[model samples]
Target: MSSKRMATIMGVTYGIAAIMPFFVGDIRFIMHILIMCLIWAVVASCWDLIMGFAGIFSFGQVAFFVIGAYTSAILSVQWNVPSVVAILLAGVFTAGMGVIVGLPCLKLAGPYVALVTFGVHMTLMPVLRGEIGIALGSGGSQGILTIPPVNILGYTFSSANQIPTFYFTLFLSVVCTVIILAVIKSYWGTAFLALKDSEEFAMSLGVSAFKYKLMVFALTSFLTGVMGAFYGHYIGMLSTRMLELDLFCTLMVMLVVGGIGRFPGAILGAFITVTANELLAPLGAYRAVTLGALVVLLVLLLPNGVMGLWLKRSDAEA
Candidate 1:
C-alpha cells in the first residue's frame, strides 16, 4: 500500500477509537474492551509484519507478550523501578529474547520455526512457575499480584481514571501504529516484501534474509512486549493463563480475519475480533468453538479475509 493510503487507514481506525470514549464513557466494560483492542492491535500488527509481510511463520508472539508483562511486573514490584522505565526495559528484554530465539530459529524451515516459537510459548508456563521465575518475582505458579498501575508523574492509569487511561493507551497505540506504518513505507518494508516474494531471489538481489528478517522480528517483539507490559499494569496482575492456546488462536483469528499481510486490516480486525469475542462471551464454553467455526468460514469463503473483500471490491470499482 502507498504511504498516503495506509496513513489514511490508520487515521480512520484511530480516529474512531479517539471518539469511542465519548459515546461509551459511562460503560466501563466497553471502555475496557476498547483499551484491550488498542493493546492487541499493535501486537496483531506485529504478527502481520512478521508472518504476513516478512513471511516468517512465527508462533511465539504470545510468549513474547507474556514475557514482557512478567518482566515489567517483576521490575516494578521487586526492584522498585518506575513503571515507565520498566515498560521500556521489558520491551528491550523481550526483544533480546526474540534475538536469542531468532538467531537460531530463523535458519530453520517455516514449520520448524513455528514449532520452535510455539515451543517457547508452551514451555513458558512451567518456567514461570519454577525456581527461576520466583527469583525474578514471577510469583511462581501464583503469578504476580499487586502490580501497580502505570504511574506518570502523579497520575495513575488506573481504572478509576478511565478517561486518562483510555487516552494514554491510545497515545501508545498511535506511536506504535505510526512506527508500523513508517516501517512498511520505508526501505525495510520494501526489503521485507522482496524477501517474502522469494527469499532466494531477494537474497540474490543483495537482501540479507538473516539480517532483515531478524531485525523486523525483534522490532515486532519489542512492540508486543511494550503493550503486554501495559496490559499487566492495567490489569494489576500477571499470570501464566495468558499462554493458553485459546489466546493464541484468538490472536491468529485477528490476523486471518484482517487478511494476513494486510496492514490496517489487522488493526481493524483487532477491534472487530475483540468486540466479537465479547459478544460471544454469553456462549461461555462454546465461544472457542464458534470462533473456530468463524475462522473456517472466513478461510473457505473469504480466504483473504475482510481486507481481501475490500480489495476485491475496490478492484471491481476501478
Candidate 2:
C-alpha cells in the first residue's frame, strides 16, 4: 500500500483502539489489553530492526530496555522532569550504549551475538538490585514503585483514566512504526538488508557495512529505550527481574512465529500473542499449556505467521 493509504488505515485502527473502552463496559480490561499489546508491538518492531532487518540477533535487548525504563523513572522521580524529555533522553542514552555494545558485540554474529547479549543481561541483573540499585534508587530486587504517569499540557494521566494512557501509547507505537517503515524503505534500510545477506558484498556495492550496522543498532536501541520508558510509566514500576531471559525468549518466539523479516509479521505476531495471553488468562493453570499448543500449531501450520500467510495467498492469487 501507498504510504498515505497506510497512514489512514493505521489512524483509523488507532482511533478505534483509543475509544474502544467507551463502547466496552470493561474499560479497565480493554485498556489493559490495548496498552500491553501496544508496548510489546513497539518492542517487537524494534527487535525487527536488529534481528528482522539486519539479521543480527541480540538477546540482551531487554538490558537496554531496562536502562531506558530505569533512566526515565529515576529522572522523573528525582529530577522532576517531564516524561517526554525523559523518554527522549532515555532513547539517546540507550542508543549510546547500543554503540558501545554493538561495536564489540556486532563483531560476532549468529548465535555468538545472542550469547554476548545474554551475558550482558546476566551481568546487569545483579547490579540492578538492593544497595547497588538503592544508590541509584532503582529499588533493585524490589523494583521501583509509585512511578509518575505521563503528564501532557495541563492534563494528567494516572492509572485511573485509561483513555490518556491508551492514546499516548498508541501514538508512540504508531510513531515508532512510521519511523521504522520510513527507514526500511530508504537506502539505509537497503544497506541493512545487504549486510544481512553478505557484509563483504554490501561493502563492495559502496554500502558502508560498519556505518549501516551501527546506524541500525542505534535506531533500534532508541526505539527500544522509548518502549521501556513508556512501559515503566504505564505499568508504574521497574525492576531487574522483569528484564529476564524468559521475557526475551517469549519475545523471540513472538518474532519467529510472526515472521522475522517482514514488518507486518512482527506486528501481527505481537497482536496475536498478546491477545492469546489475555484470552487465556482465565484458564489460569492451563494457560501456559494452551499458549504452548498454540505456538506449536502456528509453527507447524502458519509457519510464516498470519501476515506471512496472507501475503503468500495474495501473491498466489495475483
Candidate 3:
C-alpha cells in the first residue's frame, strides 16, 4: 500500500477517536474503554512493527510494558520524581533492557529468539515479586497502589477527568502512530524486508541485520514502555497481574485478527478486540472461550486478518 493509503486508515481511526469523548464523555465505563483502546492501539502497533513487519518473534511486550509501569510508578511514588519525567525515564530504561536482551538473543534462530524473549517474560514475575523488586519500591505482591495521575503544567489527567485524559492519550497515540508509520517507510523498514526475504542476502547487500533488528526492537520497547507508564498513571495503579496469560493472549489476538505485518490493522484490531472482549463480559466465565473460538473462526475466514480484507497481494503490508 502507498504511504498515503496506510496513513489514511490511521488518520481516520484517530479522527474517530478524537471525537469519541464528545459522544461518550459522561459515560465513565465507555470512556474508560476508549482510553484503553488508544493505549492498546499504540502498544499493539509496536507489537506489529516487531513481530509483523520486522519479523521478530519476541513475546516480551508485556514484560516491557510492566517494566515501564513499575519503573515510572516507583520513580514518582517512591522517589518523588514528576510523573512526566518518570514516564520518559521508564521508556529509556525499557529500551536499555531491550538492548541488553536483544544483544545476544537476536543472533539466534527465530524460535530461539521467541523462547529467550518469552523467557524474559517468564522471569519478570519472580523478579518483580521477589526481594529485589521490593527493594526498588515495587510494593512486591501488593503492587504500587498510589501512583499519581499525569500532571501537565497545572492540569491533571485521571479517572476524574476522563475526557481530558482521552484526548491526552489520543495525542500520545497519534505521535506514536506517526513514528511507527515513519519507520515503516524508512530504510530501517526496507532493511527489515530485505532481511526477512533473506538475512544472508540482505547482509551481502550491506544491510546490517542485527543492527536493524536491535534498533527496531529498542524503538518498539521504548514506545510500549511509554504507553505502559501512561496506563499506570491513568489507572492510578500498577500490578504484576498484567503479566498474566490473558492480557498477553489478548495482544496476540489483536495481531492475529488485525493481520500480522499490517500497520493500521494493529490499530483496528486493538479497538475491535478490546471492545468485543468487553461486550462479552455478560457471558461471565465463557468470555475467554468465546474469544478463543472467535479467533479461530477469524483466522480460518480471514487469514490475513481484518486488514487482508482491504489490502491486495501486491500492496505493501504497511
Reference-based lDDT, each prediction: 0.90, 0.77, 0.91
| Candidate scoring better on TM-score of 1 and 2 | 1
RMSD of each candidate? 2.0, 2.7, 1.3
TM-score of 1: 0.96
* Runs with alpha carbons beyond 4 Å of true place in candidate 1: 312-318
Question: In candidate 3, residue 137 scores what lDDT?
Answer: 93
The lDDT of model 3 is 0.91
Per-residue CA lDDT of candidate 1, range 1-318, in tens? Answer: 567777887898899999998999989999999999999999999999989888888999999999999999999999889999999999999999998889877689889989999999999999999998888789998899899999999889987778889999999999998899889888999999899888899999999999998898799999999999999999999899999887898899999888888787899889988999999999999998897788888878877777775564653232
How many residue pairs clash (N, CA or C atoms closer than 3 angstroms) in each of the candidate models, in the order given? 0, 0, 1
Error of 3 at 169 (Å): 0.2
Best by lDDT: 3
**Model 3 stretches with alpha carbons more than 4 Å out:** 316-318
Native-structure RMSD, model 1:
2.0
How many clashes does the backbone of model 2 have? 0
lDDT of 2 by residue, 1-318 (tens): 234543554465556666676776266876787887778777887887788788887776788888889988988987888987887898899899888788876578689988887777787778878577789878768888878887878676656777777777788888898888788878877888888988888888898867887897799889999899888887788878776666776677668677777664676577778887778999999987888888888878866665455454653232
Q: Please give the TM-score that candidate 2 achieves against the real structure.
A: 0.91
